[model samples]
Target: MILIRARVEAVLEPGRRTEVRVPVLLIASDRRWLELLPSQRARLKGRFGTPRSADLLAAVVVVRGPPSVLGPPSPLQRAAETVRARLRRSVDRLPADQRGVLPGMVVGDTSRIDPDLAEVFRTAGLTHLLVVSGANLAIVIGAVLGLCRFAGLGRRRAPPVAVLAVLAFVVVARPEPSVLRATVMGLIGLLALFTGRRRQGLPALAAAVLLLVLIDPTLARSYGFALSVLATGGLLVLAPPWRERLRRRLPGPLADALAVAAAAQVAVAPVLVMLSGEVGVVSVAANLLAAPAVAPATLLGALGAVTALVSLTLARLVVWPAGLAVAWVVWIARTAARLPYATIPWKGGGLGAVALLAAAVVAVLILRSRRLRLVAVAAMAGVLIAVVGLRLLAPGWPPPGWALVACDVGQGDALALAAGPGRAVVVDTGPDPRLVEGCLERLAIRDVPLLVLTHPHADHVDGVAGVRSHRAVHAVLTTPRGPGREARFTSGLVVRQALTGQRWSVGDLTLSVLGPLSAGPRLAPGDDGTTVNDASVVLVARRPGFSALLAGDVEADAQRALAGSVPAVQVIKVPHHGSRSQDPAFLAAAHASVALISVGRDNDYGHPAPSTVDRLRSLGSRVHRTDQEGDVAVVRTTGGLSVVPRR
Candidate 1:
């Protein structure tokens, strides 16, 4: 599915026909929009509904049958569309991740980016690299101005050439709100720099903001708009002073880069803290590491886009250098994201923003003295070393001899069954890739002999990418009743159907597919949540002096069916997050010593029902809930078995 912005021409309201002028979001399955320009008119037959977020859009039109083309787009728009298509085709030879990022960095086209890779970029606070931000426009304008200077052109002549470059970039990148905002901010900064009149920059920025908000009032509420303005303000106001200070000790180029990155990060910290509830500890460093490559990648990608209009072969050659630069950026983001405590979780909302702002003010006051600045730097370094040291020395987490871990993925299931060093059998990746991936990272599991997806529900399998990211999986075993939509994440892997009585082993650990006795019964062609729940693939995992029942989400009916065959074990992953629809006979049959429940805190579904918890306790089981304990691990003890809670 693709989403496009469209204007509403008419409305049919019961007996009245009304003509209206309003902007709306259009959801369509048609590929025609790829060829159509930004403002082209089209006749669409669809049902209108209230938009989820009505901040920018009046309504959402979901295209039902087909879209009717009213007319062709303008000549310029057609050329731009052609250039975009050609550019995409030219980069076909690059690696999948690089190919996706190049277009995004150039023209804000991100349809091809891997979701897992996008998550990594987000975690590292490098998402700006994948968008048409002020940095991109700054690079383009800076390059153009440098060329004019290199040719010995006068400053007066350089502005006109730079203005042309800005216009062309806006057209090629499509005059979306973000692109327009970046263009305006970039031009203001250019004007300030070229004229050597830094004081006028603020008034120009204020006028630009007033004009833009008046033109499109919705931009006032947009986070992107706010960030663009703040970043530009920081560059004009804070960067110059900081750059001068840094140049006293550092080289000119390094000082400039550090000042820009630090100013932008400082300006946007409050907003980011409130929005994401986390502070990116490594963001400034990540941006600094990525800054050198941004200019080359953006310039080359744009050049490639233009060259594609003339010759696809030449465009491919031009894009190769851009690909290498993008690869470096990708590496930086991935590496930074993997670092310990890359982001520090904090309070969210207005309170968090206010608290962070206050802290920043205090920090700035303290760092004004040279001696204090040195002290602060040393303190921060010491803290970082301490964190790394503790992480390496900490023996409390992923406790030794741990055989099974129910990761706290929130309202979903993800379990790592240890096979050997850095190897495990991952089952039921949770609803998010980041949460599950973080759990695996903490456990230091990099190689997976088998990935068992109990069912095709999103909660059971949406995190498949996290399991495969920076790791190797020999095979994937899933239930036979897999739907095409949820199974797409496992596309490149060897996926096979898990059958009853099927057995597999890796190292000393062994697994047997127990239940999922039958396929989902035939029903109407809609989401049959119950039927899917019943078809969850149940497993019995065993090792020396340890065993577990990794019951996916099978409810009452399937639980009753498996009761006769399912044997008692040391631990059991309570079915369906311990919902009330459990079979007492099945619970009695297991008689597990420890029961693990994976559910989210304050979830709307009220999972791990009170009655279910009581029933498990009555069955002579000690319950360990992930929502309470963070990550519940069943480790082997010298005498018998014990539960470890990494809270």
Candidate 2:
């Protein structure tokens, strides 16, 4: 039986806390068992303890449940907690530079790493530096082997010593599932070396993968697991052949470095492309610069970690070496990130990844031969270059015409109007910042002449981050203030009331705010109730022969209150994302030719109800749902109206 201990760190539910365990995992790597006892489960009803450092040392063991479960208190939980505490203490004693790299190098704990520093690493394409993986284990083993050889231990003894070192390192790092997997793979590789059976590396890797997947089928869904496995497999299968080929063509050191970088990149590229939809062109260059530093940083960081266990003074001295290595890595990242077009975005997922990988394999195979390899690689490279060039040079917006776009933002509202060249206006920001940013990029919108925030709901305001990215904001109009108005305003947006008689120009299109008719009394459903939806800013946009009405989430009451104040419109954004509480009279007054509804599929609220849709259809208005049609666009010309739905 594996014994574990941990302290409650965060209260996830009323009586359940997310705990960090000590001594990490004491069980077999593939062990499966229940974690909590019946008596302990019964006593979990009341608040157990405060989630503070002082209370963290009071650890508890979980005697029942699957070992793969994250954050729940268990035998493994105590071990994780203990490692975290020790690492924290180590970091606190180190210099700033070494402190930044310590946890990541030792245990893949990057939660304490600053976001700015993380971004720097990302830009440099050295993100693997923050993760504890086979690469890290390899570096450790390589260093150990080098040390043993220097001390006069022959090559045969090197493998055993390396394996022993890996086992000890795993204990210090805490035997999390990921750490265990890495250790197992490292040990297998070292054993292969000792036995002169290096060809068994692939089978060993496959076995480790199968074992881990069987123990926790859910790990199959983990991106980290996929990345780790692919990277290791790449090193085994591709690295050796690449190294030999490069060695024949170039100097020994350069060939070896290039081979390592190329093999890992080729293996992991498809997975990275599939997940991020972007390829880092500078990854090879970044790795070549950062790879040499990894061993020193890891060894010194580990030394600092051990030294911290005994004397703070000793740990501080060790930190200097680690910090210097980390600084070099940071420099590499910053330089790589700043290179023009370092990352190229592409459409991603299984098909795209497979296609790229197939092309890469064909190119590599062709290159292996003396005759046809060069031609094949050149042809493939040309095809990729042409495709990328065409996409970059393609004209994004409709040619010299006015258009209104209702961006598909899941269950929130965001609309854009392209009036003329390089000019547009944005209506309500959506619920997701990333989605909204993507929409802006697709539309090729750079400047906002005016930004209209209809109301203060999270759906309408969450994309404020995206909006703020624009260089300039000429004006921002919002609904009249009430209880939560101040809190809802986007950080830098200048908020104003949509009073009667306010006019704004967005390129060739002119806009006017029509109603609320009067400032209604602050809504109060009950003593405990706060309703922000009752107040919405309504506006009308008109250009030459086209017109549209943007009605924020104003319900039936607000609509009735405005009555005849609203004008007829060619297009109408259905209020509250087609919620059932829409006012029929408001729809009748608008007399819209097309009604746009923004909502999500299978949303709990059952939005765009049949009744509301039928009402718009009865009024002879073509109904379009963003959820169904994706991004919906309407182009208005003197001839008539044309609609575009994303394919």
Candidate 3:
């Protein structure tokens, strides 16, 4: 592979950047990628996509070598990198929670953070700390000002000291685009404090916006930059009344903390909802829990960074309390993230943002009402109780006697056969690993004793990563390898060739594999895939009374070949995503009451061909397309078999 070095830049498109990933340009190199970081250079080799979705490049290799820096960075950038490196080293001696979280709390470095723990922050809504918001800057500067006052420094002396502290913080936190954005907001807040006119901060906010945009015209287009400004405005305009109202009952310090967190969350809720397409239900409480630790962590962390310039030993000492504080914050994120109803999925886009904004307004209005406040409080208590009660009493998942679930994996097939609590027999993985993983998470499936891939097609087996991400599998079952058609997936899984008459029983339920009319279990090599569809692994699952036939993506000939044994199943996974090339006779022989077509929405192939659906329906089979419905599950109720869709 040829390698070329280039500067890295964000994806040149709006609304595509996310906290978890970024699409970027490797300038000077010919690749356009989605996982590249901003403000850096890299050497990588990748292939550009062809036809539809062209221009997108997927990297196969990212070459690692010393970067060719033409010149040294500014003093501020140098100072920031130096302090950040020292801070990381000092905290490295701490436990994972502290080591991973302290630098993030202080300088917005999360490269060494754990993935599960990162997800915990997102679920609990503590992501802002890791992003380096004005909160970090304020904490550091406030601590300096407090010390100045304690030393009996005159008011005139304090402003300069605070200003110097802010400048120093900006340096030690890096002058990257994100840090620069946050620094501007921090300076605006300082202006308010220095002038003793909190209201003037509004004007300062506007000025900062104009000034930053003039210097970095691209700031006008950055969602992260916009969010930082919005959060700062929230602190100035909304936090005071919140503090006043909360102080009526809560202690002064605690009320202030809650006020600041609530203000920022409420202010940015619309934008965040639009970007993430979901609301973190536990965000308020999670932030409140982490609030007490933020100031101490930031202040002490900054102290530790400064101390490192003198002695590493003293730096470690200063970081101890900060590490403990961060540990507390990390604990809050992890515990609360795992709580029930921590995040509620929402439809994303302009409409979703508007809806969330309306709800936030209603909440504020209700809280403002004296008499209605009591009613609202009681109503909220009842709602919380009801939600917990329902989750405990009647869990929404693994509904009683749910036989199977056909995950909506977009143009591929993945069927989950229930075995026991948190366990399932997965049949076929979709085209993408992430999508399949999401389906498993929704099903709350954590164990897969068997993962059966019907054939070697990408759509049928590529999603192995999804399964690997979610749970461990006992064995991966597939057909014997063919020379040309057996799609290869690179994984460490032990492969078992599944052919005719292989059966497994679990708790009175029996799962049997019975097809691939090959002479033996060994696949014939030099076999081109003209008849590969006919060679799909067919599954028959029954639980004493009910049975379903899961036919992989077999076309007409394979369908006809397998039809003889497929008895009249109550549910059938229609072949080839309900393509046009299906056997009418085979459809009739299956005698399925409910036929499921796992196809993508608005797919280019026009899957579930009109003839296919018509043919199935003509055979008296109720047809359901995953494109129209979401995850379609087959349930055996007292009223007989019914198909349920969950979005």
Worst 10 residues of 3 by lDDT: 47-56
For residues 1-647, write the lDDT of model 2, one tens digit per residue. Answer: 23233333343575786654222112211134334321122122222321221122342232222343444455545554555556567667555645666678766767567544665576556888887777678778888998999999986888888888887677556555566677777777777788887547788888888878887664676676787788878888999988998899899998999988878888888988776566778999899988888888888777776676677677767867777887788778878887755776655668779878787777667767867866766887998899789768854444346478888777789998876666678898887676777777777777887888876666787776776676456677776644333244555666667776688876568988875455665533221111356576788988877789988888888788776788888999998888778889999899999999988643534577779999999999999888666688887667788676652
Query: Highest lDDT: which candidate?
Result: 1
Candidate 1: the clashing residue pairs are none
TM-scores for every predicted model: 0.66, 0.56, 0.62
lDDT of 1 at 386: 93
Over 1-647, each residue of candidate 3 has an lDDT whose tens digit, in order, gives 11232333322335574232323322121123322322434433322222121122232222222334434556556666777778888887889878887888787787578644675797799888786766776676678789999999866577778878778776666554556765676677666666776546777678778888899665776677778888888888999998998999999999998898888888888888776667877898889888888888888887888898888898999999998898898889989887876777675658999999888788879878998899998998999899888768863654567778998787789988888788888999887787788889988889988888888665777788888784888887776544223335635777787757888776666878867766633445323333555668888888855688888877887777777877777888998889788878777877889998998754534476888888888889898877656688888788788777663
Each prediction's whole-model lDDT (CA)? 0.83, 0.70, 0.73
Ranking by lDDT: 1, 3, 2
**Positional deviation of residue 604's Cα in model 2 after best superposition, in angstroms:** 18
Q: TM-score: which is higher, 2 or 3?
A: 3
Please say which candidate is ahead in TM-score: 1 or 3. 1
